[model samples]
Target chain A: MVKEKEHEQDAEAGSYPTGQKPKYGPFDIRRYSPTQESKEKRKSNVLFFVALFAIIMLAVYGWYWYNTPGGERQVVQLKNALAPYNPATWYMGKLSQAQDIGNVWSAGGGNETLKGVLFDSFKVAGSEEIPQGSPVVFAYGLKLANAVVSKLPLTLSCNIKDKDIAGDIIPSNPLIISGKRITQNARCRFNSEITKELSGTVEVEGGVIFPFSTTDAKLKVYFTSEEMEQSLLSADEGDFFSYLGIDEQLPLRTAYNGEPIELGIGVSTENEQPVVLREGYNPLIGITLNNRWDGKMLNLTEFRLIIPKELSINQEISQNPNGLCPFTLARQGKTTNEYRASEELIEQVSLEKGRLRSFECWLDVAPELLGSAQYTVKEYEAEADYVYQLPSRTATITVKGVAGKETGIGEDLLSPLV
Target chain B: MGIKPIAIACICLVSLFFISGCDMLPNSIPGFGGNDESSVGGVLSASIFAPSNNGKVLSDYPFKPIVKIKNAGQFEAEGQTCITGLDKDVFSVFTGCECKSFKFEKEGATSEFEPISLEFGSYTVKPQEGDANQQFSAITRYEYVTDVTADLCISNDIYEDCGADPDAGGAIDAKISRVSGGPISIEGVQETVSYTGGSDTVTLIFTINARKSATGRLIPESDLNAQCTPVSADETPKVQAAVREFPITTPIRCRDAEVSADSTATIICEAKDISLINAKGQAVFEKGYTVPITFSLRYFFETVASSKFVVS
Candidate 1:
């Protein structure tokens, strides 16, 4: 009993029993009342951990902010603000804008001014100075503009003032403009045969007003009798002249300003320049009137032709039932005789705008007048009158010399020619 | 040493809280959240993406026509598509329906998806002796609505800074807003204001023009399924226009709402006896009130695309 009481007293006094030892070391006890070094170490660890945590939090917040929509928008704004300072970006932006505008225009979405029929370009595809008896090519282009839509067909017509030169237009008859096509090109070839040097203009007229009317549409050309046969044989054969080295000479010409109405007279004989009068040969005289006005058509009221007294109208040749000029002749004076056009002829023939109307008559020389001479020369006058009260225009004709006898003229003169 | 594990655990808990907090903020905000009703701006664009121009197809063989329709605008469109300009004798459609129906969801919305492709039924080329080329047009007809918002200055004084001049009368800028992208657009706006003894009247004119490229005809909105057929040249298309919102007590009236042959239309709206007073019966003279005027135009629009191909 005394020993048990002593053990209890020892345990109460915090002493281990007999040979038992404490499970902890001296350092464990020191942890309860830490020394300055240990406390300082603990404080330093806490400080390091706090700093680490702060850095990690900062990184996380930064990543979150950068990925946000508002943050991305801010960055985009900064980049845009700096874009103008960079010349390359500025130029690229301008180039893209210009390309967009060009694309819009190509799609026919812009430019209100280009909304009607437009006269695009006019060019003479051949030489400006053409050789006589050679073909001359005139090429012109017309645009229906960008947005002009037409359900009905629009017609285009062109006329050259000189009647002696004639050929087929590429798109003959009515030049119809239809469908969604915006452009049309036309070619006019004139095979000109001339007795003398000539300079004339070809008038083009579109039946519309404004753009078509405002265009000059006249092409002036010169013809020379030199090297006629050689040039005609060597003329370029195609729908259009070759554009190889000739591009430099094909620049568009300036606009023309002149009268819209013109008149020309041509005389053809069986023989060459110096004519020969025989039993069966007669001269054909043609008078051409051109109405270059594009606005409306003009009516014919009267037409009269006067010939030299040495020659008279061939009744069989000039008075054909289906002829263009059927006339009644009256002796005016000793020098000439006047022939008046019939009422049916005046009423049936009306000159259309931008077109030509021709009045032809045949003249026969009296065999008695050509007596005893190698040849004889004569001069005469021709005049015309219109119903629209246009001023009367006149032309002079000079027939060089006519051989008197059939034997005096060559075999070429005996054949029919024009 | 014993405190190290607790410190690491606390740090991990704090990091997790921050990462999770960011995702939760967007859901809590009212207007910032994305919804199915949100809209950007634009209209449906259609293009024939298959069978390239001048492509050759074998005679007596079946071929399919594919159209790409994209809903790039704000409105959900449901329309019918038809193929025209094809010779009935040369080509035969094997499908049961002449015109097929298509539906597309609006863009910039939560339910938006990629552009939907529409495929017409198989077409067989009829046998012919010689190869020939023919032009065919693809037409899409849909009922569409265009909305326009404009702000006009309502002032009792003519010399106010509402872009008005006393010597030249009261003519102000309409301050028209940008129209939503579509086949039709408002070209110009003109406004005129005249003052009476105690009130003022304003006149507004709107000029609208249709896109020239790939745009066909426009008709009235009533019975669109019945009127979406081919239109004659002499028949003029009509649009139903309404003044949805105006600040004045008097109702606004519009006139001359017909599309002309040039693909342009003019609508003139007038408001009579407009008093420049607030709800409290106070005059707004020194500072003019900017009244927002809204217009809604409903019409059925048709667009056509054409291509030429040879059938050998």
Candidate 2:
């Protein structure tokens, strides 16, 4: 009983293992501390919020890019790639804002025509500074986009705008639409593959060209079937509408693709001053070679000068040249002469960028017997045939209001070089 | 940045570059044939009609036939002139005096004219034997001039731009837009003007040759005659001589007419005159006196036609 009493006293005095304090490492003590736990929880919350914000931002950006005008275009491209022949997927990426359009036609076959003609784009390819009337040729191109179609006829007729059909083809009168005359240059094919290709991947091309006039103009094209061609040839406007099985402007329209095509046209002259080649006078035709084209290097082939009969370039103008080209002088009429530049001489004239070439020639002018009422200014067209850096082309320069005399270059003088 | 993030950034930059570059591509894929920008030349198709060709005229002396001009091609006719000259002097008045100019608003349109009738003096008609009909063929000439402007694509590069490809070809430029020339050919005048006279009258048949000279193509007949046919009173009837030198200083004048091309036309001219009784009442001379008279012609003509084309 004395021994038991002593043990209890020892336990009470904290000498036993149960009453002793435990040894603690840095991790164990801090893990249990309220302050350290709170700090760790706060760090975890910050990381989660950052990740969520990043995900939301990415998603929002994706949605925006897919909806905007530019973004929509990308979507169309992707859709077209997936299902090329699907009519619903027909979307020309970019389009033109044109006020005037000629002979609008749809791609669909038969009377149920589609809306608008699809244009890939229109661009100016090149330009030349002519003498007078400041005549400039605007090199342009038109790409007819794909048309949607189901199985229809094997034959398709595509007509380029403003092309006059040879009178020999069909004895038909022109169809006047919107105060403009529409002529047909029909491209008819008798194959189903053509229709498929046209709607699928192929696009029709029209190098629609015109002189730079003061006013902006619209050009047109016509797409029709063999039956439609007959109607166009035989029917008037009312008759045509009746034949087409509809009235009013059909829903047929046109659309374009891609950026506004840039026409690489430029005037090479140092100054904008216009030059007029006068009649009955010898003048130097100076042309500066400026790289104003999308293409490089102009490989000249021929230079032709169409002069009024009133004016004569060296009767031996052909002989007067360096004899570099095989020149020909032909009478366009009793009142005009066609002077053709030699191919050899033209080949020699490599009009490189920053180069200046002068055509030294003599012009003989004769006065009309009855005399012109006034100093009439006529436009003379000078055309040069050349190869652009990539290929060949022709540039025309016009000299305006040139007067000359009939001093006498006649049929006797027209004997081409034997 | 981490490797993955850096890689993503690089990809985004590359994509932007491609998007910009793609815009430069030709509107068309290279393999597809190029556009059909071909232009057809304007053709002038003209047809002529005369009084005899349309219908029979009752008895109207010196009736000029109606002249009609048509624009049969797919182009507009502008500043077009139709000049008609009588080969015979039987008509007191002429058709298409000093030329007539007009315009055709559209293709396949037409213009018509009815010439006036002018005849001098009186004539007697002798009925021909059965089945004999005298239809006089008069001399008519037509000349015209015009100008036209069209769009032409001039490219410094011929092979790639215009000449090489079939679709690249363009219309060759015509230096002289003037369309004045002798459209009349070997066919003599289609109609006739008749002046019948009595037995006392002298019917002078003048066969004038209407040769299309190059000079005539460039100059008007009136101008040529004005320069060549000098006016003179020297040939007027001499009060003493029975027959004075021909009324005009020059009895026959070619009037500056020279043929540049090898071509000729036969023009028939007829004139009737009553017997000339001197102070003494008597016939001037024996009947059937046929004197030859010749007058050459060089016509002046000018006209214009226009066509429009769009090229890209």
Candidate 3:
């Protein structure tokens, strides 16, 4: 009855059943009534979750801000601020401002070494033998001392002493030099002490021509440097100055050693039109060099004569002591043969102005050119190169052949004959 | 608080970032903002459409070589196309002149759609002992004119403000408005305004330069025969330059312009005693007026294209 009464009391207090105990300890009153400590724990948990959410939001916002254009611009600004530390950047900056120093020097007296203009380099580049009726480009390089601060307008004019070779400088405009430096040292100091190179090409059309082989070409570059005193029209005006006084000319003679020489080659045969050749007959071929220039005499450095392979030289009649000229023969290619004059012989061939030198040789036509056909016409080619004259003349000869039996008639004629 | 609202907010932020990123990318996709015209700006562009390079053709058969030309720039073009390197002994003789003349309209927005083609008449290759490879060059010489107009600010008073800041030396430079795109371009113009005391006239000097690129050779329009061949030594490349229009009534005189070996020509135009007073007898010096100067340069430009074929 007492147990039943206790159960009734437990049920009235809303506790567990008679035999069951509470989940917390017997003194744990907080199960039935909320405690201050429990409330504090709940508050702390809520704060922790809120703080975690806030941290996550802050991270997302930070990533978005970093990816914006403004962030990229800040990065660029930082790089630009540190660009001065890079050597390449420093050098490039100095190069871009190379012309700016000219203004500074003009305002103040420049270095004494830069007082007068100086030509540093002058070079001529072209082929030794310039063809006739062809444009000859005279590539020249001019280096000027950095003495003048203002823009220097230079006019390049050329004159050929020989009237026969008429040439005019193309684009007769003046070359403007606004303190552009082609070469610089590590320090990038642009001044007269460091020569600045200005290279340009001056084409003289019809500069080298036929008949007028040798020419005394002179190139004159004219420029003026003067200190000007002018009042500024306004603070926002460009430096405007006029050129005063006569332009000074720097003459450069293009004639190296003596004068530029042009050589011409002519090939002739004994039988003129439609050269006829037989198995027994030998033809005489003449190679001539006409020095049309009326200038200094020059030695023939080299000469080459190429003939078709179907023909062989009559060495017995064309050798020295009896032949017109001494030459050594060699096979050139599959279808041609080359004849070159000896070094000593070429050195002795000193051609005076307006002179002609001829070398003659006899060629024995081979039966292979006619093959088994009678009265066959074949085109044979012969060329000559003298002193590296490029685009050598190629003479095409139509050979009319009559197939004839081998004959010993020309054997006696092969004897040394001048 | 429920997590659903926070999740939605995060998704919206991520979506906004991606949308903005797509906007920052270049609009290079086709059908978007791509241009149809050629990127290379020039008067004329030519290519060998027929006789494909390194292709083979039968001997003793007639074939035609065609060249496709396009007006790539904003100018009309007329030129002669010459075919070279065709061996005469190995091919049928080309009657009449070898060069064919063609004219093309100026490039418009849809000009790229209409490319002109030139057919070098039918030619039969002669039979050879064996197969031979031949190389051909199609040389096009076109006459093009580049017109440039620049607005210059002229002021009699030294203190009158004009264009940009004064150059390094306090000299005002002419402001160029437009330069037609072509092989030849006006590099820049230098203007000088000189005034003498008590003189109502102001001297205006303009230095203009015509520069050509390395792709073609510039020849004088007068030398029409030298178009398809190597420039003769006697023929200097010159441009007929004229000051077509000027603001003032004073006549402008331009010097003869010759193209240098560097493919550059400098022309100087001067107008002396240009009245500072208007026709209404009003002084125009108190405020600077813009003077539109127009320059027209006429010259012939030559470019070459090469193709190879095997006659088997």
Candidate 4:
């Protein structure tokens, strides 16, 4: 009976009576269950395993996120680190007023000497060549040292030494200071006109204090450009004098010396024709004079217009030579037949330096000499004598005469000669 | 084989939950990844200031080097940005770096520009070999963003507002003078007069540059306005060639970009041998008088600079 009870217990526990097969339906499969204590032990083991796995996984992924080679984190770190980048302010040379001193002269003052002009080391910094005709900036730094108790205003000046650079100096601002030490900035726009080296001088002026002396500085350097050399203004030599000197003597007939002046000689008539004289036309000629001396005045004595032998003058052309300043012309000397001008003419007119004066005269052509359709020019030597301060000079002009039919004279003179 | 299907499924689900739960951890945790698109905050500055480049350097010798570090940007924490404060762990740097590591708290803002004495060990150099100089780069990495603007004046009326200081350009006050070449006329003014001075030409200088106040080290990004353009930390401002137009214009072949720390750039436009008749359908500037020139320039400018340096 005890054995039978143990068998029933095993059957109920699903151990199947120590490996005996249980009877089941066609598709049914045999199953087993653990004892209460074993079931509890198994459940505990599963729970422990799950917890352990979770811990291990946490550690692995943690390591991966922390030490991943590259990702958004790296990019962010780089960005932040580079955030404080500073492109340096483009500047050169020391910022002191007296970094370099040049020729400082001081007049007697309460204590300090009034300083002369000073030069500092102000300059542009770089190696890149600037182009000609292109604008470039010449920046510099300045420092002011004031030893006096009162405030002073300073005019910091910059000058481009090379004219070819065509530079225009532009100050960043006026510098007014009362502090012991202060810095100032300035720039110059160098409008380069040539490819040659460029240089400039910077100066500090106008800081005066009774007991304290001020120091000014300037910078000098050659600025190079990459532009091709440009064409320069012509420097041809021309007539340059300061006194009223005769430049050229031109006559209406044949333009004996050069082309006739635009206005007809004497009274300056509009569209005056060629100086060829007919039986009744007036003959006029222009004498051009210029004062080449810059500032000196030219004083004169008596003036004479000598008549040549071929031209017969029975009387003075005019008692008062119109437009011949302060002078009256009249027949003088019977044998020589000279036309002498009044001394007052020379006294009344004085040519200022660089002044241009034109003297035109109207002379009558003897009517008896015009008989042919075209007359050959008669060459004659004429002279103008004048007494100027320090020197008396004579100017001679050749006069050619054309007396004939107006049409025929044009052929010989290449222009109207009446 | 004895395990129930439902129990197995439950175990698998639990495992998956643990694996995916990592995304929920605080960003401060080492393994958790955060949003990649979010902007980072922190301004780091590190640069070399001494031992300027002089074409060549002696080899295998110690040369004086000047290094500097500064907090050029605000520090952001917990979605708040502070200019004067810093984080506890502040910043970390390697000890072996050429420039020694230092903390902002100890160094302070006043000392930001103070140069640190450092030494650079030279290397071999050769002119014939076309060898490059031994470069020294100090990279200060942080997460940051900035906005910058640069104003360029194209017209005469608003030039002062754009960046041109009136008194700064001494004697640059342009006045018309009748030079010998040709006649001159104001764009729309009547009674045109001929220049009688020397040449029939005038030099028109367009002083185009960022405002004097705009040029400097890193400035507050928010201070920028419409005249300014926001540039990435790594970019710089450049003048667009196609958009530049001078009144009596000339070709601008170079200086197309603003220098790193330049306050202004100059463009020279000249009218040479100009004719009495308006050529190019533009009126000539009169002599002995002041004529306003309207200049239009287009440029891209950035106020923020990434880690950068200069040869002393």
lDDT of 2 by residue, A296-401 (tens): 3345555665555655655464355564223367546544477776676666655332223434345555444113111122224344544433112211211112
Q: How much is A270 displaced in model 2, in angstroms?
A: 10
- The CAPRI category of model 1 is incorrect
Q: State how far residue B5 of model 4 sits from its true place (Å).
A: 99
Worst lDDT run of 10 residues, candidate 3 chain A, spans A390-399
lDDT string, candidate 1, B97-137, tens digits: 24567876645555554576677657887876566555445
Ten consecutive residues with minimal summed lDDT in candidate 4 chain B? B82-91
lDDT of 3 by residue, B223-278 (tens): 45543333333455667678877867788888868776566889888888877777
lDDT of 2 by residue, B1-312 (tens): 369998998999999999888766642332111221111122233222333221332233334332334433332333333222221122233321223344545322353222222221222222212221112211122233222121212222322332324342322221221222232222221111122353333233333333432211222333222211111212211101011122322232222332233545444433344233434756443333322221223233222111111110
Q: Write the per-residue lDDT of candidate 1 for residues A1-418, one digit (tens) a residue.
A: 6656765565566665443333353234532465789889999999999999999999999778655433443554455447447999667645643432200100111223433344454445644433223455556465554343454233433344335433345664334565555445666555444312232222222222221211122211111122222222232111111201011122212122222333444454221222334446676655555444433324554556666565677778877423455666855655457776776766565544445566666777754343322122233334444432121111111111122322211223423322
Provide the TM-score of chain A alone for each candidate, in the order shown.
0.30, 0.27, 0.29, 0.25
lDDT of candidates 1 onward, in order: 0.49, 0.30, 0.50, 0.30
Cα shift from native, residue A222, model 1 (Å): 46
Rank the models by lDDT, top first. 3, 1, 4, 2
Q: Which segments of candidate 1 are over 4 A away from where they belong?
A: A1-418, B1-44, B71-73, B93-97, B107-114, B127-130, B166-169, B199-214, B220-223, B226-228, B232-235, B247-249, B278-281, B284-288
When superposed on Cα atoms, how far off is each prediction in RMSD? 42.2, 38.0, 38.3, 53.3
| Better model by TM-score: candidate 1 vs candidate 2 | 1
